[model samples]
Each structure stands twice: as C-alpha cells, then as structure tokens.
Target chain A: MKLQRVLQYAKTLLSESIDAGDIAIDATAGNGHDTLFLTELVGEKGHVYAFDIQQQAIESTENRLKENGVSHLATVILDGHEHISQHVQQQIGGAIFNLGYLPGANHHVVTKSNTTIEAIEQLLQLLKIGGIIVLVIYHGHEGGKEERDELLKFVSSLPQKYVHVLRYEFLNQKNDPPFIVALEKVKNFPKE
Target chain B: MKLQRVLQYAKTLLSESIDAGDIAIDATAGNGHDTLFLTELVGEKGHVYAFDIQQQAIESTENRLKENGVSHLATVILDGHEHISQHVQQQIGGAIFNLGYLPGANHHVVTKSNTTIEAIEQLLQLLKIGGIIVLVIYHGHEGGKEERDELLKFVSSLPQKYVHVLRYEFLNQKNDPPFIVALEKVKNFPKE
Candidate 1:
C-alpha cells in the first residue's frame, strides 16, 4: 500500500461489524476523505459528526459529501477544537482526526497542539467501549513537531486499563510527513 | 509513542484478545520486532512461526529473540514465501507481513509481488475464522511502486461478504514511505 492506503487500514482496524446505526466522528474533515469513508462504513442508518476550524475546509467537505449524495449522513461543523463536545451528542463508535492544515490550502493556520489535545480529551470521553480515536499527526512544517511531540506525550500517559495507545511512523523519513497515533478504548474500560 | 509504538498498535489490533495458546505467524520477521511482539501476545503455551528469506534477517531476528528470552516461544525459519503452510500446522489467530525488504540492509533483495501474492493466498487458507492478515507495504524505493500497486489491486478485488479489506496510508505525504493493508476473514466467509 502507498501512503493513502495506510489510513484506510487504520480505519478498518477501528471498524466494527455492529449494526449500521452506530455513530461516528470526524474530528477533522479536511476535504472529507475520512468523513466519506466513515459515512460509508456506518451505512445509511448511521450518523457522522465532522469538525473543522476552517470555513474553507467545511465548505469543501460539505460540497464533496453533497456531490457524492452522502450529505444526509453527515453534519459538518465550522468551529474550532472546543465545540466538538457540545456539538456531537451521541456515544460514537469511532472518531478520527487528521491533525494538520487542509491540503492545498493555507498551511500557516494549521492545528495547534493545545486545541488538539483538548479536542482529543473530549473525543475520548465521547467514545463507547471498543471504540477508537485515530489521530494522524503531520510534523513537516514549523509548528508540526511540537504538536506531534505533545500529542504523543499525552497519549502515552493514558492509563492502560482504559485505553491502548499506538503510534505509527517511519524513523527513516527526513521531513516527517505524518504518522498515525491511535487510541482504542478497551472494551471494558474501567469506570470511575 | 515512537516508531516501535506503531508496531505495538499493530500487535494489539491483530491479537488483543487472543489467549496464551493461539498460533501466530510473523511472515517477514525483519529484525524480529513483530516476531517478539507475536511471541509475547501468544504467551508460552502458544507458538509463533516466523519466516524470512534472508539468512541475515533470520539470524538477526533469532538473536534478538534469544537476547530477549523469547526464542523458546517462537520458531524461526530460514525459508521464503512458500514455506509458511508447511511450518505452521495449527490454525493461526493472526499473520503479519512487513512486506518491504530489510531496513538499513541491502535494498536489492526486497519482497516481490508475485511471491507475496502467492503467500497471501496460502495464508488465507491457513487462517482461522475472524483471523487477520496485516501487510505493511513500503513503496519508497525502485520496483516498490509496481509491487505496491499490484498488491493494492489484488486486495481491492476481494469480495465484500467473505473478507473485509482495509488499506491505510497518509494521503498528505510524499515518497509514500509505507502504509498498511489489512484483511479480516469474517466468521461466515464462504465455505463452499
């Protein structure tokens, strides 16, 4: 598989064979690739809540979904990190975040580690048992490395009983295009 | 989580709930990271059948495992693609192939699509229901694009009912370091 195919493999690992009515979340809906994938995986009966800080991103994703005849299954939000918890009401089966700027757009207004960390904290809480959150970190630009490093630290500290965290990257790569950091909530995550 | 942590994630996805007595296969035991992970996941009662075409690879993996005190739980073989079925007698819980050649070693002697495709077919027959096969394909070098493209085409053509296939890659990256392709044999895979 090439670079794009790896994300799909991660999605499959996070997918469950349960009924299609289960909810899913897209923490970042850049160009709607993941949002579209999740919508298909969850089927017509399912619901998808997508978030993006950029209006351009939201509009592009919305157009993509509508053009593909899947807009009914998705709800795109044009808000930053803090709005996700209040916007998405359902206990989701899985959530995904592509943590970088929208491809082919302004790279300067990219994701910050603080907001991403906050958004992830809320997303994890919203996940159900056996649910997963996939965070794809891209550290090629100026602020990228800090976000990647901080996110790794945060995920590494999550308790083992409640979650299993995994990071995927190629050490040989020079500029650090991006890598995958996935969190799977154990089926029996301990209750407080 | 660094690069090794990604392998840890792969390990959890493939063998999270498997007991201590399950059989597993490390198709490309390069440097033995996945081999050792498989050994630990399977426990002492279980067994891991690891394969590598290169004598240097098998020897290096064996040494790594022995140093880690896990050689007893795994059986390292100095055979290529076609020998997996002969080496593993029991139904496998999971099989993993880090499909590119040995890293930091000669890039000339890498995995070819022909042998890999054949091996995948055989392993599919050997896998138990609900079993998984993960292929981490690196398409960064010469001849990589052809192999990767062929493998993707092969996996994508699989029927929907029996086996669910997933391809994961970072869409935003160049050089396309490597990505993941996974196949899960459903419980009700066609028996006829």
Candidate 2:
C-alpha cells in the first residue's frame, strides 16, 4: 500500500476507540479533511475545534463542514494552534494535525516547529487518559525538512511515563512520503 | 500503551488481512507465540512453516503447538530462517520474523544481519502479490544494535515499485523498544 492509504487506514484504526459526544481537535484544519473525519467520528452531539493560522484554511474548512451538514458540530478558529489550551476549556478525546503547507496553495506557508510543538504540548495537557494525537508529517517541500526534523526530536524527547509515541513511516518512498507520529496518553503512569 | 502491548495490537491488526487456507511462515519461532498465532490464522486447510535455529526453540514451539491442538497445521523446521526459500516451495501469503535471541535462552545467540536479509530477500521473491511480511525487531541486546542498523539499511534500499515498507517504532522509550518493519508487495505497482 502507498503511504497515503496506510495513513488513512491508521487514522481509521485509531479513531475506533472514540465515541459520540466526545470532543476532538483538528490542530491544522487545512481544507477540513481531518475536521470532517473527526466530526463524523464524534457524531452530532460531539464538538470539534478546528484551528488554522491562515484565513484561507479556516474559510475552506468552514465551507467544507457546511457542505457536509455538520457545521454546527465544529468551531473553526482563525488562529495559530499554539493557543489551543486557551481556546479549548474541556478535555479533548483526540487531536489530528496535518503538518506542511496546505495542498494547492503557496508552499511557503507551512507549519513551523515552535508553534507546532507548543500546540502539541498544550493538547497533551488537555488530552484525557487513553486519548490519542495523530500528526501526519510531510517533509519534502521547502522548509518542511526542518519542521519534520525538529518535530521528530521534540516528540522523541517526550516522557514515556505520560505518553507513548509511535512513528509509522514508509522507508522506500521517494521525495519523502508523509509519515504519521501517533501519541496515546497513558492511563496509568509511573506505575507501569 | 507499553511497547509490548502496542506490538500485540499491531499483530492483531496485521492478522486481519490474512484469511483461512492461506500459506504463512514463522521465520523465527521463538517460544512459538507468533507461530501459534499464524497457525490459528491459517486454519486447518492452510499450513504454516515455522523455523528456528535453536533446538530449544523448536521443542518449545512444538510443545506449544501440541498444547494448542494446532500441531497438525504447522511444519516446524529445525533450522535457521535463512533457509526459508529452500524449505518453503509454495507461494506464501504472509511471514513473521522476530529478530532477537529467544527469551529464556542464552542471549548471545541472536539473529544475524546477513542471514536475516537473505531470508527476507528470498521470501520477497516467493511471496505472492499483496503478501505481507512483519518483522518485530529487538535491538536492545548484545550484538543487536549492529544487526538492527544493517537490517534497516537493507530494507530502506528496497525498490519501491515492487514493495512498500513501513517502520513502526516508539520514539520515547528506554532500552530502545523493539519496532515493527512491515513490507507488503504492491498489488498494482507502477500504475499507482
């Protein structure tokens, strides 16, 4: 299978644990793909807070959600995801981030390491036990390599007592196929 | 979400693709855990060819199989998995390799890089299209680091047109948590 299909399969597998009425987050709501997916997974009673620094992304995501008839279930935020904690007051069941520039747009506007890391840290604080965070990393484009390297280092440095990190990457793909780094919050830390 | 439990989850997820009456292989039948899993997955009509370098592993695997009442479905081979091509004459649907010294045995006797790579290459040739190979790499023991490095280099060099390789590893863990490198033969390569 291609890396894209494999990532899709993984997202579906990870989302299986989530149920209706749960709160989810789309940290990088580019084009609303993951936001739509989270909306469906959380169902009508649930809520999704989608964030994007670019106004284009927020508009696109909102339009997509409206078209899907789930606009009421999502709150689109036009700001950097680093402020996730300030915006979201409730515990989140899951979060999804697609790193890199939005497709079909200027490649120069991409997710940076500092803000992304800050967003992850805030999300980690807000994540409930057994919750998961999936980051799909694209690193072939300009400025993407640095972000990928920094993010890998950051995630690798996280304490294992609180969260478990898993990286799923294709080894033989050319131009660096996007990879997934999934973190699941531990239910019982230090004891394990 | 310990590495062990995560590996178990991966095994269950990968096994969902296999069907009854399919031919499978246990490249390293250490303690027969995966061998038994494969036997049950293949059912009575199918067959599993399990291999091990140590007599203790073969005996333990045999005992485990007998106790599980699936002994008749598996052919336990008392040899290194490097000879898989010689023993397995038919097309295989899936293969599992546990790369490390068998538990409860002398830790010095570990899987070598040369033979493991040879077996993997042979299995790739013998594997039918859409077949999968799962390698659970344990590299925390003596002489294991070099083997892991060599294996990763080898797998990373494989051509992408014929097969796709995925490396699943925990980023934050002590003693280098064993990771999974799964290879699946492309059903429609080049076209994609």
Specify the highest-DockQ model's number: 2
User: Model 2, range A1-192, lDDT digits (tens) per residue?
Assistant: 423365685576447545688999999999998899899989988999999988899999999999999999999999999999889989888888889999878888989999999999888888888888888898888888899999999999988888888887889888888888888888534421
Off by over 4 Å in 2: A1-6, A188-192, B1-6, B188-192
Error of 2 at B94 (Å): 1.1
TM-score to true structure, per model: 0.53, 0.92
Displacement of residue A71 (Cα, Å) in model 1 is 23
> Candidate 2, residues B1-192: lDDT per residue as tens digits?
422354785576447545788889999998999889998888988999999989999999999999999999999999988899888888887888889999999998999999999999888887778778888899999888999999999999988888888887889888877888888887534432
Q: Give the 10-residue window scoring lowest on summed lDDT in candidate 2 chain B.
A: B1-10
lDDT of model 2 at position A51 = 96
List per-prediction Cα lDDT, in the order shown: 0.76, 0.85
Instruction: Give the alpha carbon lDDT tens digit for every residue of B1-192 in model 1.
Output: 111233444565676434578888889988988898888889989999999988888999999999999889998999986678777767788889887779878999899998898888888887777777888888888899999989888877766456667544433233555677767766544565
- Candidate 1 residues lying further than 4 Å off, grouped into runs, are A1-192, B1-8, B188-192
Expressed as tens digits, the lDDT of each residue in A72-103 for candidate 1 is 99999988866788888678888888887899
